[model samples]
Target: MPRPYLLFTQHGWADTNQSMMALATALTAKDEAQIMAPCLDYAMTWLRIAPLIDQVETLATATLAQQPELPLRIVGHSMGGLIWLEVLNRHPDWWDRVDFLVLVASPVGGADLGRILDPLKVGLGVAADLGKDRRPLAGRIAAAINTLTIAGDIDGGSDGTITVESTRVPNAQFVYLPGLSHAAMRCHPQVIEHIQDFWAGKRLSEPLIPHPLVNRLRQIPGMTDAHLRDFARSTPWHTFTDGTSIHLWRSPFGIDHVFLASAQGDCLYAGYVGWLHGEDLRRSLDALRGEPELLEKPIL
Candidate 1:
């Protein structure tokens, strides 16, 4: 059977496939829906120019071409979400194909971090193209699609990396969660519930009951606080790849990106950030032909 919804994760520079796959694992349980998180190529960051949109459209077309019946829904974390928006802006026809767009901690407005660094130096060239006066991809897509931007309030105001205001687009619905870090929103079950409820026809404005574990994770030491700090310090860089690199991030069940990597590894990681069950992480690592260190250490 074809997938009805595509859930994707667009990792910032510091993330990896392992982290996103771990998120996909946590979102699943005994009777949960099936989800796949494909890692995207690094070029998405720099390919922010016009061609990047074409890259995402091609991916959506390919996913649906394999199974034409499946509807498309795009979910991108960080810049990947913006990539999805860029795809839709160029291909308005795909608007009907997309059921929902969930962006996790993405800077729909120009990111403050990007602004802080001179636009010329940011390797992805996104800063260069997405100039102060230039309209953002998020702003462009918000006018065309059913969009939702979710920001984490772990740092009181901002989601560690993106500010609350930056995640806002003109017409799209916006959500702000307290305590959840920018990266942790992926693993937060409440986020999954929000997505599922939206899939079940809930309005974008519907209120959701908070997850119980949301509070407990903060009480535990060395975990929540550590990630919070990491989220703040996390930055993006370039990734070096030869030839045409097709990075298919699995946020929307169908949409993705294709890019040409520069000599420098100047791209973002296609990963997810969330609180995952240790057992699930173990299983996912096994599935990915990798081993997780969490499984080896004794839980004190």
Candidate 2:
């Protein structure tokens, strides 16, 4: 029997294979293909895209060698998208290997926020890559293969991290989603649907979720913070994503209160910052049904 299509997913800055796994789980549900996700390190004092791309190139080359006849589909987010642009540009032969490509809120233009820290040189590598006028391979990418660009927008503007303008690529089809953020784009149900549809040859149009519910998604940064929670809504509510939701809030008085709740409002990861809560936190996470990494990881 022929092998299933090989789906590869690359994650953005500071994120891990965990986030991409959720999408992979959904995409491979029909036994259509096996998915692999590679992670990049954007930790403090160390950040560079070249090495990251190199790793992907190596992976792609090796994967294709093992299964030369299998169809390939790639999905990249933020920096991950930038990495693939270079991968295909550098390895022109991979063109035939790829059956479909998807870029989710990737910042084809470049992320302006990176400039805010340019002086520190801490994240300049990524900042320059995300700039709108900074991407050189963008046009080449669109020319070689049909690519879909997905941009997320919260109510105010931008996907909380990436601006719609930054996500745009010349000569490429663009889909703008309301009530979605950069992080949310990686795991949002609607976002996933659009990507799956695109893979199935559907034009990227139609908004997945309503504007009102979009406002309440936990994809927004600081959604769990005391200040942001109080500001965003008057009534207490859980985030839109499934699994156990945990938010560590620090009071003005310096007391840290950890709030944990299920998608149905059941407490899952709650604790006081004082002591002996690590084990309790881990125990709670053990019962999580969907994407626990979304709850455990710090939301930047």
Candidate 3:
């Protein structure tokens, strides 16, 4: 019998190996495949594209060294996606080693949040690394391999931290999860199923899966229902599209309550909407990205 392919799962910035381990574990349950979850150097200080490219190539080379004969498959979340792109670019020969690639909530078009807070040691090459207009590696990534781009949209169309726009690229199959967040895209069962089917050569259907809201607002760590009431009729509201920005001011009590919506008036995400820690909170938000002074934050 032919050997099963090698599946490598890479975690996003400030994320642990376990971030991709859940999906890895699920893929290996039947003992028909093997998944390798590698933890990258997710430091805020080392976000420059060149240095990061070197780091990823090293990891990929070593992994391939172990079982060079097996065909390769990859799943990268957020920064992990970019890392793999660079790996393929730096070592063109590695492309021969890869069979399929999946990018989940990766800012291949550039991270809007990175552009906003680049001063706080978030220097992932903000100059050329954070916008859709300057996707130099798109051609490299779009070549030869069938790349799958999956995103979560809880706010009009965002995964709380990444906009669906930020995660897309030309010549790639895009799957959007209307009810999932950037982080949740990593572990959501629907997301796992998507990866599983795509890896096994199954045809991805049209009108991708839809995730439903589950009163997840009150699930935020430091928020309560009282905080959500701040969005009542008289309250000021703001709106934006994917890869855009929205500023919310604290209501004197040192807290900002936010809600996310689509242009046609549809809700996306709900939770404790606070600043400094991250995006997504007691309110709904869409077209949002990133965290402030937060090494690690949750997506809406």
Counted clashes in each candidate structure: 20, 6, 16
The TM-score between candidate 1 and the true structure equals: 0.56
Per-candidate local distance difference test: 0.50, 0.62, 0.59
* Model 3 CA deviation exceeding 4 Å by range: 42-50, 119-136, 205-300
**Residue 186, candidate 2: alpha-carbon lDDT:** 87
Better of 1 and 3 by TM-score: 3
Q: What does the lDDT read for residue 70 in candidate 1?
A: 54
TM-score of 2: 0.63
Question: Which regions of candidate 1 are displaced past 4 Å?
Answer: 1-9, 22-36, 42-55, 119-140, 204-300
Rank candidates, TM-score, best first: 2, 3, 1
* Model number with the top lDDT: 2
Sort all candidates by lDDT, best to worst: 2, 3, 1
Lowest lDDT 10-residue stretch of candidate 2: 218-227
The total number of steric clashes, by the backbone 3 Å criterion, in model 2 comes to 6
